[model samples]
Target: MNRKKKIKQILKQKAKKANDKLNPKRKPRYVSKAERARQEQQVEDQ
Candidate 1:
């Protein structure tokens, strides 16, 4: 039971990895809140 579930999960992960390698998704870069505040401050100062 437990062994079967674990095997299934591993196979699922392998399939997902292969699919992603073939068709990768584009992810936007993340901007932290502190960085955002700094940018706003710079704009206001200028």
Candidate 2:
């Protein structure tokens, strides 16, 4: 809420974005609940 805290948070966000850009990480893809259930059903059938 304070000015200093806001500035620090903004700076932290900027730094994080820069770091991620420089050394990007591979994040896993997200599967929805229905898709997950379908996959499980397929596996069970196999």
Candidate 3:
């Protein structure tokens, strides 16, 4: 039982580390059409 628990703990730690490395910390940026238009307007004004 102890050996099984130790193996499970090790596997869980490895999986968590792999997942953290694979996944980004921040969400992706999604620009809406209105935001894009506003940015374009600002560029034109400059």
Clashes of each: 0, 0, 0
Ranking by lDDT: 3, 1, 2
Model 2 / residue 7 / CA error / Å: 0.3
- Stretches of candidate 3 exceeding 4 Å from the true structure: 27-46
| Candidate 1 per-residue lDDT over residues 1-46, each given as its tens digit | 9999999999999999999899967986899999999999999999
Ranking by TM-score: 1, 3, 2
RMSD to the hidden true structure, all candidates: 3.2, 4.4, 5.5
Evaluated with lDDT, which candidate comes out highest?
3
Which structure among the candidates has the greatest TM-score? 1
lDDT of the candidates, in the order given: 0.96, 0.95, 0.97
Summarize candidate 2's per-residue lDDT along 1-46 as a digit string, tens digits: 6999999999999999999899866887899999999999999999
- Candidate 1: where is the Cα deviation over 4 Å? 27-46
Task: Please estimate how well model 3 matches the true structure, expressed as its whole-model Cα lDDT.
Answer: 0.97
lDDT of 3 by residue, 1-46 (tens): 9999999999999999999999888987999999999999999999
In candidate 3, list every pair of residues with a backbone clash: none
